[model samples]
Target: MNTSVVDCQKRLCPLRYLPRQPLSDPQASSQSASCVATSACESSALSFKRQAVRRSITPEFAKKVQSRSQVPVSRRSMRLQAIRPLRSLLHSKTTVSSALRPWGARGFASALVDKQVEGERITKVAELASEQAVRVTFEDGATAKFHKLWLRDHCRCEHCMHPETQQRQLDTASIPMDTPLHRLEVTDAGDAVAIDWDAPVRGTPCTASEFDAQWLRDHAYALEGGNAEDEDTAPYPKSYRQPRLTTQQLWAGADFQLPTHDYNKCVDNIEPLMRDLYTYGLVRVSDTPNSMEATEKFSKKIGFVLRTIYGTMWTTNPTNDAEGYNDTASTNLELLHHTDGTYIRDPPGLQIFNCAAQAGEGGESRYVDSFHVVETLRKENPEAFRVLSTTPLPYFTVDNDAHLATMEPLIRVDYAGNVVQFRHNDYDRAPLTHLSFEEVGEFYKVHRKLLEVLRRPETEFCMRLQVGDMMIVDNQRVMHGRHAFQGGDRALIGCYIGRTEYESRLRVLGII
Candidate 1:
């Protein structure tokens, strides 16, 4: 090779620039020098092609580049001209350019190559065995097992899955119980796990499909006898194990306080507010602006204000609203422990009440976790719990134009029998149906028992909200009420927020 060619290759392969070892063996130096020359020639060729495809330097771009580098375009152009002959020499055989590339360029090239190599490795099967169930160990040391039924139902080929939606089309029920696997093999490059069926099962013919290595790894289950931490299982609820604090536990000392945050902090960083809500099912934000607009803005931080017959946001005080045939929330009477909007199908997930003005003596706010009460009732009085959980009660709201009503059990349970919500509004209780005379009588007895449980001294947590203090409660779990006030200026601005929206914000913040 020419002397210049060797230097060019050295420039490309900077790794060879490291100090050479003692040449006790002369052959090592020759071998190293030959390698450097070959690498430099290859890198030059690749760099030439890259430069050719790059956009032609406009005057503006050139000026910007020159300003940043403090270099003239002519000097840069002359350097490119010097490499043109070398580029032409190596272009026809493109292999040399990559080998001769500089460290940075080589690193980038290797990254792409690494990705392809990794994909190939993932599909390589390390082991395959089937006794009662089919198991596979991947080349990366990860292992997985699949039930025959599970594998048949999860086929992802175009024939088994809808190409557009990527949803499985296989009928789970139609899969035969005696389905047998003929053979299982790792595909070339280790991209997938391919399975072959021995014969037709049910009406479907023997078929084969490739399961992506990544997909298998994700869905794989840990071995049954493995350590608990190694098991792949759905995580427990974020709010699970939260203390079911009693009224005494909550207000234990004079310095006792609700989980509180500043209004601005609540808006700017929602994690604290969400954390409070998840733990206590309620949070108090202080120093909020004493205006209905501020309440609306605060509610909007969680989600949009939920509009109802009273509109998106409303004000309630002794002087402004009428104490006629309407909701008790609008009146100044001592209200009972209950959740709001039981009459609506989808009750507000969250409720916000900003105390714009303080009252004279009595109007203290009260809260109780109905979920806690339900758990107690379930444990103490199983019969009463059954009645409340099974009997559907009617809740209705009759306003000037609205006659909304809905029927649901007092205690709502999810599919897994976990308590999800509680609906109890004595003032809004409508006529009961879908029950016999004896059942109706029993329901009333259970209902009274439930109310007694909620009204327990240990269950009620009270606080007198001051001006600029706002309370945010989870309507699903926490029931709130208020005491009667006599002679002071007591005003509250309030709004509702949907639970879905509140959760969406938490998800966006990655709090849940």
Candidate 2:
């Protein structure tokens, strides 16, 4: 390690002085690295290499330093002698350096051999030639590998990604399977890295991409070599993904509490409402203005109204005629606990139902926590749970206007082995011809077991929503049904909110 050349005194940035792994930036054209050559600490031994690295400091890193410190890089200091760092955002303590990934314009920092190291970050970046990827090592001895093609495909530069729309401009199909990287280094204060895509047989030439360290960590699929025993079995890898916000608080009849909200106050502040809805899978709002307008207003708080064949804002007013909407809910029939829209991919996240008019008797709402049922099944009947979780069932709805269909497992788990979604609807479950005869028998047995769980008295939360009450249900996590009705004009105003927009609202509100 060097003893004295590094100087981070005051009113200057020492970002360019630390040791590097022999790489230079082609972006910095205006500045010269010789500004500190006249300083007493300059050594003739490494003079040529030192100046070359300093001159290549990216402007983006300097801007970040200035913005973070809230200190203007004064004009008087740019032309002066020794360069020292004004520690504010970055660690302002004794440090050392290395050539990890491309630091924004930063040189790596280190602690003495005896003292414990702090602010540990990427300390080394190397190409894993055999793996066709690049590997980054953190100071704590952790390594993550990113395939070269994946890196090239995710370039977010202006040329690769559209600025306003934030969509990819490059064609993914044209990229080589094992993309070559002519250059790749950590950049942006070691927060991100720059990549230069080597000339390929299929894709664009000399493409450059910069990826954030955190992004790399989040999307890292494997280390230098993956473990065969620890192979991922989750259908979806959590690469920058966490499907559910919190562990589902599964409930039976005795343990459940139907969360209630004030419709008026929820309009002003929906955080508490959102918290309850996501935590318990459903929430009831008291004092709702029993009108379609009010229902639409309340539904928008969750997300835009999801348009379907049943219309954007639909009203379920049971009719005597058999030929009504394609849905069973359209008629006054005793509906069993089941999930809605199982026929559609990316089903609605939340379902809103406001009692605009209450029936005289019957038509009581029934809800069962699907997540809880699946968990119980997993514990009591492991084989049945496995069969249900692994088997795909088809659901379809054909109407005069539209035909919708989808095939998905009853229980879906993430790569982390956490249950992420539940899709169960026996009423909509079309046919079972796709499965083998033995598999079909198993599916039937497990499905019956699931029905038994659903039929348990402790599982269903029965309620008769009063006029002016609004109920918001987490469609993916809860199965909803209603008791048959015969008397009075019952009207329920409701709409579906797409899961995409529902999750987006949570993110924008910082609830997730």
User: Which one is best on lDDT?
Assistant: 2
lDDT of 1 by residue, 1-512 (tens): 32333233323322221112223334554455445445644554334334211211123322332234322323222222222223222232333322222212221112111111133235334323344456656564555667766777666554464322324456667766767677678766565677776544443443765665544554565433223245334333211211122121222212335788998766545556776786668889989999987788667767778989888887777654553426666667998888999999989999999998877778999888888888888988989998898788889988857899999888988655777788889889997777899998898898888878777787788999999999999898889999997777788899999977775544333334
TM-scores for all predictions: 0.61, 0.68
Off-target runs (Cα >4 Å) in candidate 2 are 1-120, 162-164, 171-211, 223-239, 242-247, 320-323, 398-408, 413-418, 431-436
Q: How many backbone clashes does candidate 2 have?
A: 12
Candidate 2 has a TM-score of 0.68
Number of clashing pairs per prediction, in order: 8, 12
Give Cα distance to truth, residue 53, candidate 2, Å: 16
- Residue 205's C-alpha lDDT in candidate 2? 39
Compared with the true structure, all predictions reach lDDT values of 0.61, 0.63
lDDT of 2 by residue, 366-411 (tens): 9999988988988899998888888989999888678889999989
